[model samples]
Target chain A: MSDPDRVLLCYCTCPNPASAQHLAETLVRESLAACVNRIAGIQSTYRWKGEVTSDSEELLLIKTTAGQFEALKERLLAVHPYELPELIAVPVERGHAAYLEWVRAAGGD
Target chain B: MSDPDRVLLCYCTCPNPASAQHLAETLVRESLAACVNRIAGIQSTYRWKGEVTSDSEELLLIKTTAGQFEALKERLLAVHPYELPELIAVPVERGHAAYLEWVRAAGGD
Candidate 1:
């Protein structure tokens, strides 16, 4: 059995290239993340004003340990600009041995 | 420049399809996320034991507004089995207006 509290996935997005780099560095310096993967060109869809719409966006995948979640969130809250910033985590059920251990070591101070 | 305080990206992962579906449902039902995009066949590379290793994994791309983030995380933590879940958030600076509005409405109870 895996401890839900042990690992975390920090998902984020930015309008441009600049903010993405800024946030990634902030998380790392604060010891809230081990690595940040910045991916460009993501298309998204949602309903607004009773209408469905879509747009292009950038995505960031942050890898960190569970223990650092709270602090990571705080750092994010302090700098993000949306009325409600997005922050969601998924439980990692199973994975390859080397990757799991890599995550453990990388997401540490 | 945009305010570094609004919008967020929530990222998480699971070892298989079943867990991914479960978490996506949990987030949507709880209104922490408006939608979850489940993508299969992600190849990951990382270093462990001072050596680089790689593997294939599944990916979950979740979309939710800022307000729903914390609650969404709580729900994910409640059911995840991993010692650490992947949770990362990025700021949304510029995007299609329709999509932004949609995110705001869908992420609410």
Candidate 2:
């Protein structure tokens, strides 16, 4: 079994399907992520500057290992349109072993 | 600042939108989760009965506290349709402070 902390699920939001698909494909193709799931039509409310605003956004659930995170983040920033995109990484505590292994293996060093 | 591990982003999949909405609303109403983001139209490939299968599933991105996780998991297990639902908790390492605080405050003790 892999160390739970080794795997990460990174959360990021994109303005549309085009950007979302591009980012997801980039991560997987570059071996920076095992898989990326795009969740569409989400309403996100956040305080930007001084006002609270809500926007329709697409969420990308990027699955990768800790070792691949820095590179992943760098790649995301290079292509993502937002000046400061939301990139939060959450560490997995426990998961289905087989699936976890698949995730770990998918990101080749 | 909240301990990074204090906030959990639980991942769970539902067969359809109705079940996903039900689960998300239940957790928020019961104060077990601060919020739940339902991601519709996801393709999940997994192994079942020694065979690989892919299914269209809705993914729930549940935000809650470590303090509320036990109760949250219990409620999820009781209400989730699948005999064995995927309830994986991932600990947030970092996030926008205000957003993280909002997540913490939404769940009343």
Instruction: Give the Å error, residue B29, model 1.
Output: 17
DockQ of 1: 0.06
**lDDT of candidate 1 over B1-109, digit per residue (tens):** 4432345666677777677767776666656777665655678787868999986666667777666777778888888767777888665533334446656767654
Q: Which residues of candidate 2, in runs, are more than 4 Å off?
A: A1-5, B1-9, B14-39, B43-56, B61-87, B91-109
What's the i-RMS of each model? 9.3, 4.7
What tens-digit string does per-residue lDDT give for candidate 2 at A1-109? Answer: 4553388888899999888878887777777887676777889999989999999998888888887888899999999999999999877875555556767777764
- Residue A50 Cα positional deviation in candidate 1, in Å, after optimal superposition: 3.6
- Give the lDDT of residue A94 in candidate 2: 58
Docking class of 1: incorrect
Looking at model 1, residue A89 earns an lDDT score of: 51
Best by DockQ: 2
lDDT per residue, candidate 1, A1-109, as tens digits? 3352455666666656677788888887776787888876554444435444444556778877666666777787778765556555544556776776777776564
**Candidate 2 at residue B62, lDDT?**
94
